[model samples]
Target chain A: GAGVSQSPRYKVAKRGQDVALRCDPISGHVSLFWYQQALGQGPEFLTYFQNEAQLDKSGLPSDRFFAERPEGSVSTLKIQRTQQEDSAVYLCASSSHIDSPLHFGNGTRLTVT
Target chain B: SQKIEQNSEALNIQEGKTATLTCNYTNYSPAYLQWYRQDPGRGPVFLLLIRENEKEKRKERLKVTFDTTLKQSLFHITASQPADSATYLCALFKYGGSQGNLIFGKGTKLSVKP
Candidate 1:
């Protein structure tokens, strides 16, 4: 793909249900990041990966949030035991290098009802 | 913890004029500052980036100025068009704590009217 791509543009899961969000970073891009944007707010960083190595997962809200970028290409963010607060737009962005500008996907809108 | 902030209010300007948005931060030194434009219901698109050593950067009609001393960044759009209407976000790449992850501000909405 020309840019970052995310699967399941929209996901509505019942409270307590588990959901998985996928992100496909640009080919050959070495850096990937995941962010969560609540309505009316800017994106908050959740995790970052540099070629399948999770460098930072400190921004993750809780233990229920887990992200993996296995093989350094595709990444998945799994939310276990989802709650109403988990409802937000999940954004994936990638960059060729640490200082390069990021290219973002449209983002997956997750709603936990 | 470091924090980034942008003017929460929306900015309105006439077409062909210029618009300026501000980003402020504290508690951490940033290596670079980035500006992005985000339309409703969409992800942010990169505009311009300025490193701490550089005072300003320009891309066509878009200009950005970074002042590490002031801990602020200004985003300017010259000869603004209606197509330029969007929420403008600012971010910084911090070296410590989280290396590659960016810290973003809330963003300011810009309305360029024709």
Candidate 2:
């Protein structure tokens, strides 16, 4: 793809249900990132991947949140036992390199009821 | 604790005027700072980046100034137009941290009136 692509533009799940969001970054990009944005708030870091390596998962709010980029291209963010507080837009971004500007996806708006 | 603050109120300016937005941070040293523009229901688009060692940067009608000592950055849009109306965000890359760990301010919404 010419830019980062995210799937499931919007999702509504009941509390305690599990959900998965997908991201397909720009071709050959070396860095991929995941962020969660609440209404009226800036995007907050969730995880980062350098190719297939999960270099940082320090920002994940809890064990219920998990992300992986196994092949260094497509990534998935899965939330288990979702809570109402988990409702937010999940954004995916990729950069050509570690120091380059990021290209972001339109994001998936998740609403946990 | 580290904190980033941006103008809490929306800025309204007439077209052809210059729009200036402020971003301030505390309790952390950032290697670089960046500015982005976002529209409603859309993701933020990258604009400019300034390193700590650099004082300023410019791209076309956009100008960004970074002051590490004061932990502040100012973003200016010259000859603003109604189409330029959007939320501008300020992000900081922490020193010695991965780029994916960028910290962002809540952003300032700008409205340009014709």
Candidate 3:
């Protein structure tokens, strides 16, 4: 794809279940970001990866949230013991560098029942 | 605590009119501010960015003004069309912050009716 791509446009999981969302950034992009967007709210930063290095994960809300980009091309966000509050859209974005405008994926909507 | 705020209410305007949205931040001055447009069920698309030193920036039909003293930014869309309707978000990044530390406002939804 020409732009960032995310998998599993929609997912439903029962409370206490685990879920993993994937993101494929634009090839060669050096910066990738994960964000969570709740209903009627803006996307909140979750974690950021520079190439293969995970430089910042301060935005992750809880210890249950984890993300990784092993090869710097594809990334995954894993949520363990999901709760109803975890239901939201997970957005993935990439940029050529830290300061460049971001290209965003359509996002994956997760619903925890 | 740092906070970013955008108008919680939606704005409705007629086509051919201009629409304005407001974003305000408190406790910290960001090095740069950016505006993005998001349609329903879609991720936000980048629009414009203005640095702290720059007072204003413009594109084809969009203009953004940043006021450091007031800690606010205004986004304007001139000659609005129905196609321009969307939720507009303002994000802030401070210098020396991590690359993905951008903080976003809740966003203001704009509706342009023909």
Candidate 4:
């Protein structure tokens, strides 16, 4: 792929609903990352993966948020029991290697009502 | 704890003028700093990077300066155009093992007027 791609560019979820967002990273990109951006704020780190191995999940705000990049090419972020505070843009990015510049996707804008 | 700050207010500048943006950090000694440009409804694009050892880096109309001693960085756009209107973000990467995660500032919006 030329760039990272995310599915369902916009989503509106009801409170207590579960939502799943998907990301397709560029071909052969070994490093993938997830970030959450609130309105008018910078994107905050959520999780990161090196190939199929998820190296860091410390940035996830709570247990309700989960991300996985199994098989390395595609990734998914699932949120359980969505809350109003979970409304934000979910960003996905991919890099060729560690320390390389990232290529980002348009992101999925999640609105929890 | 570490924190990165960028001027939250929007900056208005005339076309062709050099636009300067600031990024400051505290309790961090990053090995590399990166700048990215983001437009509304689009993801951020990488602009420039400055290493801790390098004081300045330039790519065409973009120049970035990093001062580890001051814990600050400056991004300058030479001969700015309205096309350059976007939000600019500054991020830091740790020296050793933490390579994938990037700590980012809130970013400043630059609006260039013709």
TM-scores of the candidates are 0.96, 0.96, 0.96, 0.97
Model 3 TM-score relative to the real fold:
0.96
Better of 2 and 3 by lDDT: 3
Error of 4 at B101 (Å): 3.4
Give the alpha carbon lDDT tens digit for every residue of B1-114 in model 1: 788889666899999999989999998878898898899878899988899999999999989999889999999999999999999999988666563558888889899999
How would you encode candidate 2's per-residue C-alpha lDDT over B36-114 as one tens digit per residue?
Answer: 9989888899999999999999999999999888889999999999999999999988745743658888989999999
> For every candidate, what is the interface RMSD in angstroms?
1.4, 1.6, 1.4, 1.6
Give Cα distance to truth, residue B32, candidate 3, Å.
Answer: 0.9
Q: Write the per-residue lDDT of candidate 1 for residues A17-98, one digit (tens) a residue.
A: 9999999999999999999998778889999999999998988999999999879999999999999999999999999997
TM-score of chain B of each: 0.93, 0.94, 0.95, 0.93
Which model scores highest in lDDT? Answer: 3
Scoring the B chain of model 2 against the true B chain gives a TM-score of 0.94
DockQ by candidate, in order: 0.71, 0.70, 0.73, 0.69
* Per-residue lDDT value at B97 in model 2: 70
Model 4 Cα lDDT, one tens digit per residue, A25-104: 99999999999998788889898999999998888999999999879889999999999999999999999988898899
Q: Score residue A57 of candidate 2 by CA lDDT.
A: 92
The DockQ-based CAPRI class assigned to model 2 is medium
When superposed on Cα atoms, how far off is each prediction in RMSD? 1.2, 1.4, 1.2, 1.3
Checking candidate 3 for backbone clashes, the offending pairs are: none
